[model samples]
Target: PVGGELASHQWRTEHFNNPWLLGAAVLVRDETAINYNWGYNAPAPGVAAENFSVRWTGSVYFGLNTEYTFYATSDDGVRVWIDGGLLIDRWQDQSATTVSAKRYLTEGTHPVIVEYYDRTGPAVIQFWWEPGAPPSPPSVQPFEIIVDDQDPGFQKAGPTSSWYFRSVGYKGHTYWTYNSDAQLYNSAKWFPQLPQAGNYQVYAFVPKQRADTKNARYRIYHSGQEHSYSIDQSIYFDKWVSLGTYYFAANSTEYVYLDDITGEPYASKKIGFDAVKFVSTAQPGPAVTPAPPPVTPVTPTPTCSIAPILGFGQVWNTNPTVRQRLGCPTQAEISTWSAEETFIGGYMFWRGDLRLIYAVYNNGTWQSFVDNWDEGQMESDPAIVPPAGRYQPKRGFGKVWREQAGVRDKLSWATAEERGLQASWQAYNGGLMLWTQTLGVFVLYNDGTWIQP
Candidate 1:
């Protein structure tokens, strides 16, 4: 009789083989025997073996080393073997079950055989693995900066309203005023006081109909005086026009006022003002060199050993032996070894095991140099190029070497062993304290700045 329909036809019909015989007739169902088909079948259900074993050639072993999970519904049975040795064998009657196993094997090819049966529900089997699994690399953390309207010190005032000064009435609105001296203007007005001395661009929105007909005049008052400039050009009405930029000197007070003197009656009646905005155009001054504020320099709690390197002015050394001796290779990328000092010129060198490199800042341009040594022969001129400001020299040696008058002479070298001299140079003169590493160069500045090149 044929096994259940869910079983593979090939497995049910295939003959079993053993060492003693090429082919053996194995009874799948024998109700007379209580332990039928090696106790894999149930007698009450008219036992049948859905899977028949077959052997050929040498012993079969599915030599695999990885994760393998088995899934089956209603009833599931599986057995794993290596070199004719059973690794796992389970014959059970139960609900769906999932199992995972990992094993290692020899390099030679192996065989994998699985037998599964589903009595009343779905069945599935899958296996997967990743050899030589490695840990995930680190990733850069992300950040963001947010800015709002209130950050710039500006506030909005609602819809426009008309100010009446005299008996002049336009359209249905009468402009008769008891106070004749009060000037009639729009709702928008500049701040009564200027925040600080800076160039400011003012934007005003006036209706198009009024802007086209009536020529508008406006003046900006700064430092208690009205600016001589006037906005006489017809602006696009209902649109924002830069009323032009005005400069307010340090400690100056400013405001803006508008007057409608156009003789067209229709233009005067329709002229309405919307909003006004003020933006600063002042450039910030160079950062001030902060005074060394008097503070009790806390004596660091003395530790067992001093830090490996001293922090000081820029230092340059091309000895790979020194770099390795100082434990520099492991710290090439994260540490700063050299720095630029503001002096007759701005430039410095960061020494690495592979080369003697320099970072030169002439005027404001920055360039990098890579040095190539010809062993015992005379050294060739270093190749110079513009680097992406941050330097990592694992690829090769980089030296910022150029014969510009103010370039090479400016570098003042100090050693990691000379702590006092390094500290003095850092305190008095600004430059980099360089550390040479196998991967690249590291620079530390006197002012607590570090750069990797």
Candidate 2:
């Protein structure tokens, strides 16, 4: 054998930025069924905005060594192979559809491979399988299981909106979200744990009445970016309407969100949230989640003095959130991280092993790599300064800055607001001002002393 070492059937997963599986792809946190309907929005946190692909590999164990039927319910394109043999091959961009095949196999472990691409718009995919029952011939579809609203799979899972399962709407009964005046922020969710993980087609059974608005919206939260969709509830009553397709992660924070924007143009009309469905689509080659390389242990630190890093006299008596995130600094020194934001002193603490620890003298703000690197928030959220009655993003800066690959690429700091200022950099009301061309006006505050906003 080449190299005298067999390439183990270890699972490998990769995510693509381009829909065609070409160009370059990122290694995702995990591989999953592509059953998502991120209508008019990014797929998931850290995923591409649109046009992406996914590939996964693993070994499967066929029980009884019998022939198994496999399905691929997908939009765009998909290809599957098991034990070096092709099973399902439907490669084209189209509406959500299903295709299947039967294959004989030896029992025990066999390698499986899957590849998929989403060219545009709402995207979904699923892989499903079961013991074969043989030729249903053409024109007739095979059997599939559906997870409905009234079923145990449907769950109440949201922190933003209120909802109720009503008997007066779509198919026998429908769950509806009320008090949705907040639009994007208000949301209701439908979560059903599938029998297994793979691609699945999702549909909604919602009815619209004259009193309802036409622009009811829902967001499909799946493995990638959360999908946003607008539906006019005035038509398609009780029909099994497609809500695109998506890859749903089991036990992951994935769920469909029905927002409260019931078309304000329709004169404060109410929105409808009803039964949703998930039908089996594609089946994975292996039943196991791909494992990543073991995490390297955090290295032990060398002993160091703390007086210089702590600025002569500084206590960990402020911003618990930041303190909890960054941990106690072992050896900190005055830093000049940002040239614009002036401070009495900025401290860069070393926790070793490439850990990032930052602290500012003002209000004793500090955070470790968790809040800074993992969460990737540029500024500590709510920079709470209870001792001084001042908070981060105070007043004109109450908003949190969005995350970007780089701090400079972000549109604006979360706290800055547009006030129609003209100068590129100016001092306003005793605060530093910069009219950033990237987003909006920004004002920075730096004082050795504390003051309330």
Candidate 2 overall lDDT versus native: 0.44
Q: Model 1, 232-291: lDDT tens per residue?
A: 224453454454445455342455554444333433334333344555543222211111
Regions of candidate 1 where Cα sits further than 4 Å from its true position? 1-188, 192-194, 208-211, 228-237, 249-253, 263-269, 282-453
Candidate 1 yields a Cα-based lDDT of: 0.31
Which ten contiguous residues of candidate 2 have the minimum total lDDT? 287-296
Indicate which candidate wins on TM-score. Answer: 2
Clashes of each: 29, 34
Measured by lDDT, the strongest candidate is: 2
Stretches of candidate 2 off by over 4 Å are 1-147, 156-166, 177-186, 208-211, 263-267, 282-453
lDDT of 2 by residue, 1-453 (tens): 112112333445667888777655576544433345555466666667668787766555555334566777777788875532345668788878888765543344544667777887777766656754432322323223444556665555455235555566555566555434444434556776655555455666675432155555566666543544445566666665555555556555766666665535423566566677665543322211111112221222222222212211221223232122223222333222221221112221222221222222222111111112333333344444422322233211121112322121111121222222222332111122223223333222221111111
